[model samples]
Target: MSDQIKVKLPDGSVKEVSKGTTALDIAKGISPRLADAALAAKVAPLPHNGDQPEARLVDLTRPLEEDSELKLLTDRDPEALEVYRHSSAHLLAAAVLDLFPETKLGHGPSTENGFFYDFYRQTPFTPEDLEKIEKRMQELVKEDVPYAREFLPREESLERFKTEGDFMKCHFIEQFTKPDEKISIYKTGKFLDFCRGPHIPSTGKIKAFKLLNIAGAYWLGDEKNPQLQRIYGTSFFSKKDMDEYFAKLEEAKKRDHRVLGKQLDLFSIQELAGPGLIFWHPKGGIIRKEMEDWMREEYLKRGYSLVVTPHVARTDLWKISGHTGYYKQNFFTPMELDDAEYMLKPMNCPGHVLIYRDQLRSYRDLPMRLGEMGTVYRYERSGVMHGLLRVRGFTQDDAHIFCTPSQIEDEISGCIDFAISVLHTYGFNEFKVELSEWDPNDRKSFIGTDEQWNLAQGSLKKVLDARGIPYKSMPGEAAFYGPKIDVKLVDAIGRLWQLSTVQFDFTLPQRFELEYVGEDGKRHQPLMVHRALYGSIERFFGVLIEHYAGAFPVWLSPVQTVLVPIGEKHLEYANKVGDVLKAKGIRVEVDGRNEKMNAKIREHALQKVPFILVVGDKEAEATSVNVRTRGKDKTETVPLDSFVERIEKLIAEKKPTLD
Candidate 1:
């Protein structure tokens, strides 16, 4: 064994220290301030055979015996936040044990926004109990108890947990570790359990935390098992950050598409029709028509040939596409036909592939853009469905581009432009993109040869760089078939929604042996790109509802102009105005309900009519109207002809605002 080891810091400097020097010792050697700020350390040990070291989180106080590169993580680092939240979960479990000693603990892990722990107790935890548990948590934090990690023989650990009636912990230990191997456990104050943790130094580091709510969850997510109390909570580095998160949570609740869908009367999911299926009501149908028409027009303008495909195909077709072998889990059950078996198509790739291979094509037709508003049906777990976002059936604005290697980059660039236009035209200007690249180390998770993957990834990166578009690289997020680019749009209240995708599939083209004749009269396999601007019509509509809070722009509004007459005397003039709008292809309606003018205006406002034109006796005689735009308190009067011209321009431009 070496007496001294060289430890490399993030800044390329190395320190010759004793072999067992811990990360905390290194931090304190540098400065007490660095030691104080750090929550955990990410270390990559020097590999013995020249292989790259795998970076993993470790306790700051854990020993660094070998030559390793170390990074001390603080709140500023995104990874440290995850460890902080995980430690907060430990704090929550400690508090729960302190208040109710008999309750057994389950797994507590950090979620996307927060942390949750499942507990089994004979008595259900109530709102008041949550308050008490939170108070106890504060007390535990004040005590500054350390999260002490220990290793014990697996048999001994299981015996101890069994003595405490912690069957869940015992099960986890048996499932995750061999009986002969040592088991890792974490202890905080009097509470101790089985865990592998790189927790913060102590409970004191968990500064700001709130226990949000409680719900019931089955053990291991299996309903057949006993139910447990799942307590949800979130923690932040500062009180201000926590408060801002709560405020954002409130805003998200207000903008929930399910609630907005009801208020706008845009869509519904009926019980009779079963779950995970959408029912587009009349108003919603009109909005969908506008969306489809706009997309189809763009397809033609961009030189794409629109085509249609069937909803179902023979199971043999899916088998040929490798969908049955690779994607059978997402497929609906196969139906027994007289001649052969059939299945609902989960994707439009094979259908498009069949079209591409239907006729022999020369080099002049090398780049064929086949587009569709193709409806696909797939199986969705009953519990996972959430309104339009997760559905059993959906129409995709799906398109496939079959181009030669030289033309692949240009095709991707065109797809990106179309995707951006879709977002911008729908009123979302702020967006972030991600390129999902496969992990070369885990080659089993992805397909294609090294050269093919390199060429595809390089082309995508080149197009993004040429366009000067900013995107985050997400390694290992790529699909099994190939790499992809996902565009997530920021909504009105600052929620990110994933809508558009441009994916490269090297597997499907090869599976179908797709080819086009080259200039040399040789059959060459064409590179296939599958892109969906509006990934799914249903999901996009849901995002649109939440993005605009159901107050769609003039071009998307079902009833664009509503004529509200003040009295019966102005009813004739209101009808005439409606006639003019209808002739211009504007969606117009006259609200002649036997109600007060104010009542009519209030109703129309609730419906989110873009323009509510009030016609009274004087206004009708003068051929002018009072316009009350949605979200404004006051109404302005304008000449009828001028109003028509202004609205036509707004609709033509698809302005995000009436102004």
Candidate 2:
């Protein structure tokens, strides 16, 4: 065997190096600046060989034992950014250990926007402690301590961790490492951790970072186990980027739905009634009614038959639908009944399936669409639950289209049109579409023949292409039964909300034995298209609240116009104005509270009322009212009839803004 190994650079340059030379050595040979900038190297064997030809990230100092292709990673690469944040987490751990030697380490992984590390300590870490920890981390960064990796016998590693009373580490060792395996350990200064890591060369790479906050997490996520202190933090390649991120975070805080929800008195989740269950207050209920009314009207206009299904079904139904096998982790336990086990519905597709199979279908019924505003329940983990975004129970604007293969393209196109209409009507102008197709290599994760998958995926692609819409192709993101298109709308703050989907299904029809007679007099299985425009009503409401910053349009606002009388003397005139607006089918409220005129206007504005009409003696006598619109600084005095006509026209059009 040749003692020299060939190292292929990403730019097509090759270098001859001694077998034991490391990637860092090659980088140094190229340039000292490159060697300093690189955080890690992604290396794969040369000749482009192996069942998995994917390169794996490793420390730059990792020895190259054979011919390989190497790509050095820096802050410019997203993957290296993840590694940088992970190293920041390691620095956090090292800092914590330096400050408190008694603390035992748990896992620390890089999250989407930041990183969090778990630690087991007797004393709870206070805000002051977090500050001290951050201070000490800076000192470690200045030291530029090397992160040395070492291999130890599994038994020795376990014994070492056990000797230090690191029960968490010992448990991880026993759980992950085999008896004859050599456990990889990473040591940063005096802080040693049992981990297989591709960390940066040193701690100095972690330049811009901060300890955000702390929360309690159950050990291994088990309630019965000890709760560990999970410290959250974020890191960036530069100070400017970190500053920009925090600025966006501050803006997000201002638009937070939970805060606005209470301020606007729109919705609430009561504790006694349990979590993830929303009780829409009067104001919120009004908006929800408009939402439901619009949806139902569209259902009729689009030729879809409205249907209602039971909230619970027999466990056998779920079993036959393949949900019991596919989504077992998300299913709630079955309720024991006198006849059989019953289950809360987790989805509405099966209910529609049963409805379609309720009668004989002829070729004329080639395209049957059934729609429902169905409430469903799923078993969500406690820690994973967020406001309305993730909840145990939700109402879905779900519909199912049963059609023949010949009519699939038109049906899919119609669904896309409906979805886009919903977005545009709701004032969402920006959105991203994704086509999720099955992964052929991972056959077990999917449930369909190759022919069925190809046909379904081809139909979705062709429709999108024919419409000239650009979409991201996401492999391995399809539902087990078939492929799908997911539409995510970008809100005002630029956060993407997953709100619509059109999914194809071949397995469900076969499982339910659904059939329709064709023109050729042959019974054939029908194709199923599951479409949900709003995803979940509660979640969509939350998005709406944040999207418009609680300032709804004239049609959707709970109190379209609040008549604020300047004093008790004008109360009669205010009442008259409210009556006139009420007669015209407008939602009007009279603010006759014993408060100052400015206070009344401010209060109504706080509630995000569309119009705050102040009627005084002069205005009342002139048959006009002073109007203060939401999100406007200047007030306009207009004839009561003129204002009514204007708002009525706005409401009729469902305009997104006053102007």
Candidate 2 lDDT tens digits, 538-572 = 89999998899888888899999999999999999
lDDT of each: 0.91, 0.92
TM-scores, one per candidate = 0.92, 0.86
Candidate no. 2 TM-score: 0.86
Tell me the spans in candidate 1 whose CA falls farther than 4 Å from its real position. Answer: 1-23, 26-31, 44-54, 65-70, 178-182, 439-445, 465-468
- Candidate 1, residue 48: Cα displacement in angstroms equals 13
> Clashes per prediction?
0, 0
Q: Every model's Cα RMSD, please? A: 2.8, 3.9
By summed lDDT, which 10 consecutive residues of candidate 2 come out lowest? Answer: 46-55
Candidate 1 lDDT, tens digit per residue, 23-112? 899999999999998899999986678798779999998887788889999888989999999999999999999999999999899987
Highest-scoring model, lDDT: 2
lDDT agreement of model 1 with the native? 0.91
State the displacement of the C-alpha of residue 391, model 1, in Å, after optimal TM-score superposition.
Answer: 1.2
